[model samples]
Structures are given as C-alpha cells and as structure tokens.
Target: MTQTVGSRALSSPRELTRVADRSSFIYLERCIVHRDANAITAEDAEGTTHIPAATIGTLLLGPGTRITHQAMSVLGECGAAVAWVGENAVRYYAGGRALTRSSALAEAQAVAWANQRTRLDVARAMYRLRFPDEDPSGLTRRGLLGREGDRVKDCYRKNSERTGVRWRKRQYVPGDFTAGDTVNQAITAAAQCMYGITHAVVAALGCSPALGFVHSGHELSFVLDVADLYKTEIGIPLAFDIAAESDEDPGPRTRRALRDRIHQLGLLDRCVTDIKSLLLPSGTQASEITVADSDIDRVSLQSDHDQLLPSGTNYGDEAGW
Candidate 1:
C-alpha cells in the first residue's frame, strides 16, 4: 500500500471534507454493536444489522445499548462519533469514542480565529448562508449581532403566525424545564437535540468545538455557531408548531419533528459539509505529509539490493542460482 494510503485511513479533517454520510444516522437501543469480520454490526432482540461506520456521522446509543472495543476502534477509524443517551435518547449523558487525531484543522481554525479580518470574513460568510440572497457587506460585527437578534425575534413572530400560536418572545430558564412557556420548552428540547448532532459532526471532522467565529466564551462556542445556523429554519418553527397542539408536554413531539426535519433536510451530511466550508472557506485545507520522500527512496534502494540477478545475462545465470 502507498504510505499515504497505508496511514491506513485519513487522519486529517481536510481529507474528510468530501466524505459522504453512510446512513446519515444510526440510533440503536437495547442492542450491542461489535465487529463482524471487517464490518460493524449491531445485534438486538429482532436481528443484526450492518452499520456502515465510515459514512455515519454519529451513533446514538440509548438505554441498554453496548459497544465493544473493537467496534469502537472501527468507528474511530471511520471518524464517527458516539453519543450516550438516556431512554428514548432524551438526555445526553456523555460522549463516547470519537476517532480524530489531526491537528491540521484545529491549527487552521486557530489561525483564522486569531486574525481579525479573516475571522470577520468567515463570520460574514456564515451570516450570508443564514440569510441568503442578502448582501452582508459593510456590516460590522456589532451590526451583525443587531441584525441577527432582530431576525430571531422576527422568526418567533413569523412562526407564531404560521402555527397559530401566541408569540410573546423567547424565554427559557436553565435547569428548569417547566419554567419556560410551552414554545420555549419545546425550543429548548429541540436545540439540545440539534447540539448533539452538531457536536458529533464537529468531533468527527477533527475540529475544536471551543474555537468559534460568531459565538464565543464557551467550550461549545463553535457547536452553538453551527447549531444556530439552522435554528430559525428548523427548531423555532418546529417548536411553535408543536406548541399550537393541545399536549401539555410537547418535548417528545418536538423531538420527533426535529428528527424528521433533520432527515428531510439531509442535515447530517450538510453538517459535515457546512463545517468544512466554515473552517476552510476556499475548500479543504492541505495537510503537511509527515513521511519523508528520502525514506521511500531508501526503501526502494534496499529492495533493489535484495533482488537476485536475472538469468538472461551472460554473467547472471551463475549469480541467479
């Protein structure tokens, strides 16, 4: 195998820019995921299903789900992230094995983040994506924040109008799920779900979640930045629609709706693509090759020395024997 190929999988996020999602998602419960020959398989009460780890962004393991070390290794090699959740995948407890070791993406991210102009360009690109068809030129960072806030308020009002729900503005109290209105609660639940998905994608791409362009001052600043890109389009609208319903608790419904929207939007795959675009706007950044060409030349020279002489030459027959 070529040294680059035998590294044996890509260890750099830049190399993963074009990687496609295998299944988009794999949520398993009451099952065990393990290695079956060269493939990853999940065994449950019903049967065993093959999991294409390489293309999957995240594996959600609910209550009763177990994974083997070998399977974890396979998922890591595939650059997939694992999330440990509660029953029905409602609560995210902790993260499991996520395969990534490249410093290239992280370093590139830092370089942009450290520069004022480059970071502003990235932030502007993100804003342009969020509000397409609108030019963000001549807008300062503070001006962007004001515009973003106005748009968010406008989103709530628009969703309320579309869903026939009363809009009073977004309100949520951390650690107190019931403190917020039904719409706020639903939005909170949906946002959490979105964060889980974003976290998985960010980790898989070998990027630091701590570094961010728009949002800052938090460990998950970048996660929040990516998550917010779709909230107005997905979470807010879904929450309002759920709130218009008669259920006393709409968290479950909102979550189901979010999952449906995620698939409908092809979000898992988009997440990977969007992250790459954000970190490296010009496209995938190049990673420096670690193995030296001299090493390869030395190996080729040694192979030539070890080979016996061919038998066709006049002096070769005696040496060949």
Candidate 2:
C-alpha cells in the first residue's frame, strides 16, 4: 500500500462508494495488479491503467494475472470482490470480500433460511421478483421449478424470434463450451458474467451464497437465484444480440456487452436493493444498509438479553464477581 501525507490518507468504509453505484465488474489478465494509494495499478507490456478501487464492485482476475497483497487489501477495504478465474473467464475458482462488517443482513438471511415455511416464502418472493405479473404464492418447490423451466423456454423462444437467431433447445456440456452452437455459447458467456456479478454483490453484502431459497446444495446457490432474477431481462436478450452480430469471439463480446448493459441499466443498484429486500424483513429502512463514519471498525460483544458490550474492557470485577 502506498503511504501518503496529510490530505491523502486511507479511506474508511464510510468514504468508499456504495456497492450499487460502482462499476459492475472489470476483467483483467496477463498483468501485475498492485495498489497505488486508493487506486489499483495494472501493469502490462503495453502500459499501466489506474483504476479507482472504490469505484469497482468486482475484480475478475483472469489467467496470468498476478495481484499483490496490497492490491488485495485495498480491494477488501473498498468492498470490491476479487475472483480468480480461468482463461476467457469461463471458470470461477474463488471469490470473496465483505463490504460491510455488520452481520445484520447475514443474520436475517439465516433466520429466513432456518425454517422450511419461511424458506418457501423467501423462494416465492424471489420468484415473484423475477416474474412480477405471475403469482408464485402457494407454489411448491417442484412447481416453482416447473414454472421456471417453462418461463425460460418461453424467454428463449422470444429472444430467438426477436433477434432472428435460430432457436433450438438450450444445450451445452458442463465443461465443454464448443459443444454448444453460437447462441448457446453466447448464453453461456452471459450467464457466467451474471454469476460473477451476482457473486460479488452477495459477498459485498456479507451474505452466505450457499443459503439459497430456490436454488440449493451448491456453494453459489443463492448467487444462482439472484442472477436468474435478470436472466430474461438482461442475460438472455444480450446473448441473443451478440450471437446475431457475429459468431466469433462470443465470450469477450458477451462480457463487454454485459458490463456495459449492467452499467447503463444501473443493475448493481437494483441488485443491492433486491437482495436486501429478499433477505431483510418487510419495510426495512434503507438507512440500515448505509455505513456511517462511526460504524467503521467498530466491534462489540454479544451479551445477555440481546445486548452488546464494548470490547477491550474487563467485566470480571463487575456484579457477577
């Protein structure tokens, strides 16, 4: 990390840009990424690009990217997610960063997930968000799955017709991208980008990505659920458009398109709002999500009757003794 004098001090959590207002994600490869004060400098054979760390929601470190510890520290402090991915950004090996140290949202998510009935309720809420015109209430998990499958098929049909792309059933092997046609390849690329973005938001919110309402059993089940919220609205349509334009370099093209669309649509802000609405209780104030100057680095110990006690104090000489 670069040390600075008077006015150029390190930024506190309160000073960092809100996750919703930041850039969706940046994909970089074959570079050395290091911190330069509040910005991260990416050095390559061509040149060095300085990116404001506070403005980035996610950093997708692709193959051949070597990031320094200082860069990682600054990203973590700025609440930016750092993901290690394979070439062409196809494989997601790991990603994490908690923008907020507070556990309120995480606890709320756990409470909702711990019960069967509430879990179903949250799942219904998620489906409702995705398909606002339809009523997913009282629908069982299997019914929801069936409904989702039908909706996705309908979406594919609609996009194919609108884009004049040949419509076939969605097909692609898990690890094999070449097995799919041009459209499928584009869709896969778009979906991967969506996952990366959603995963970053999930981590930034300090919520467990494994605890999903509709999707389950996988580590990124919740991420999948959130990403699907905009599949029809963003991913599917964009993928079709890419396929219609050209069959070459579908991955990179799709990624660039997705990033631009995300920014233009202000999807990051909407995503943050939707996740909070899904995990937090009804009518929860938006102020609860904001980080205040005093809240930064504040730690407290849980006590009896839901009270919190300040740390670094000796309670042994108190009434109990």
Using lDDT as the measure, which candidate wins?
2
Error of 2 at 162 (Å): 0.8
Q: For residues 62-159, write the lDDT of model 1, one tens digit per residue.
A: 67988899988767666666777654224443343333344456667888899999889888888988889678888999999999888889898888
**Deviation of model 2 at 262, angstroms:** 0.5
The CA-based lDDT of model 2 is what? 0.85
Q: Please provide, for model 2 over 96-191, each residue's C-alpha lDDT reduced to its tens digit, 9 standing for 90 to 100.
A: 568776778888999999999999999999889989999998899999999989998999999999999998879878878778888898899889
RMSD of each: 11.1, 3.1
What would the TM-scores of all predictions be?
A: 0.70, 0.91
All candidates' lDDT scores?
0.70, 0.85
Give candidate 1 misplaced runs (Cα > 4 Å): 1-19, 30-35, 38-50, 87-104, 176-179, 245-249, 281-321
Instruction: Write down the TM-score for model 1.
Output: 0.70
RMSD of 1: 11.1
